[model samples]
Target: MKNKIEISDLQVHYRDTSALNKVSFDVHENEILGIIGPAQSGKTTLLKVINRTLEFVPEASMDGTVKLDGVDISTMGDIYGLRRRIGMVLPLPVGLPLSIYDNVAFAPRAAGLRSKSQLDELVERCLQQAALWDEVKDRLSTLGTKLSGGQQQRLTIARALSHQPEVLCLDEFSIAIDPVTTMRIEEVLKTLQKEMTILLVTNLVQQAKRLATRTAFFLNGDLIEIDSTDVIFSDTPAQQATYDYINGTFG
Candidate 1:
């Protein structure tokens, strides 16, 4: 399979603390690459670096390289252009104060898409992709923040999809939503994988086993192991530590 994103000797430092240590991995195109680890294992840090959002962190610095589609992201002239190719959904749902329609429309408009018909089609398509259209189609003008937590979470996914990113990064996206909604979104992700590569970071090992083509285990900022989901969840993993973590013996 072709690689959509590649990381080599990647390191992230925040002040005196190291957040990611020499992490290296490849995200295959059109595949869902799951990242699983305990808290503070640098999973989120990895996503931020991939999307270049880590630059906003105070005292944060990085070494090594991250490449998207064979192009070094660090060498990109337009940060916004780079970000537009990667969509990110966070653990917590963050809805803009704008109406649901406007929230999903925000990205395209910012990209200079002005045709009302185009915006309408984009909004519906994204919302549908997010599994949110049926719930919000009648309330397009309503404030996005007014929706339920689960609805808002799905809304965030729709907003992320508005840019039609080549890569989608989801960091513990189901953490705050109810199980039913989480499952629904999981189904959406399975479908979306046909359209874009996905980077999924979740503490839930079972979720990774269910959705990921490949899984990577992280421990104390280190990438312990990365392999096919079958191998990662096998009776004996490539690393004893990975086996322990997956077996509920340790994180």
Candidate 2:
């Protein structure tokens, strides 16, 4: 498969604390690359760096190159365009104050999609993909934040799919949702991988094993190892730390 994203000797820092230490990896096109690690291991930091949203953190600084389709994202003139190309879903479900329909339609509308018919079709499609269409179809006019936590999380996913991004970055997406809802979204992600590359930052090792084409393990700002999911979860891995962590010996 072709490389969709390339990170070379990437390093990130927050004030005096190092977040990512000379990390490097390639995300393959239409594959779900799972990032597994314990807390403060830099998984979320890595995602923010990829999408260039790390700039929003006042004390954050970065080094090295992050390229999307062979072009360095830092050199890209249109930040908004870059962001639209990579959709992000955070751990907590953050719903816009707008109605369910408007929340899903927000990004497309901002991109100048003015036709109501087109927006309607796009909204329904995204919602269906998120496994939330049937639940909220009759209540599209209701505020998005009014939905239950699980429903709101699905809404977040639907909104992320609104612009048809080339890369979808989900950081602990199931953290705030129930198992059934998480499983539903996981199924949605499996279908979505046919269309876009996915960066799944999950603490759940089994979740990665179930979905990721390949898995990378990070520890205290270091990339311990990366390998096919089976190998990473097997009796042996390139790094003992990876095997240990996967087996729950230590995180």
Residue 146 C-alpha lDDT in model 1 = 99
Model 2 residue 36 lDDT? 99
Clashing pairs in 1: none
lDDT of 1 by residue, 32-119 (tens): 9999999989999999998899999989999999999999999999999999999999999999999999999999999999999999
TM-score of each: 0.98, 0.99
Encode model 2's per-residue lDDT on 93-182: one tens digit a residue.
999999999999999998889999999999999999988999999999999999998889889999999999999999999988889878
True-structure lDDT of candidate 2? 0.94
| lDDT (C-alpha) at residue 136 in model 2 | 93
Clashing pairs in 2: none
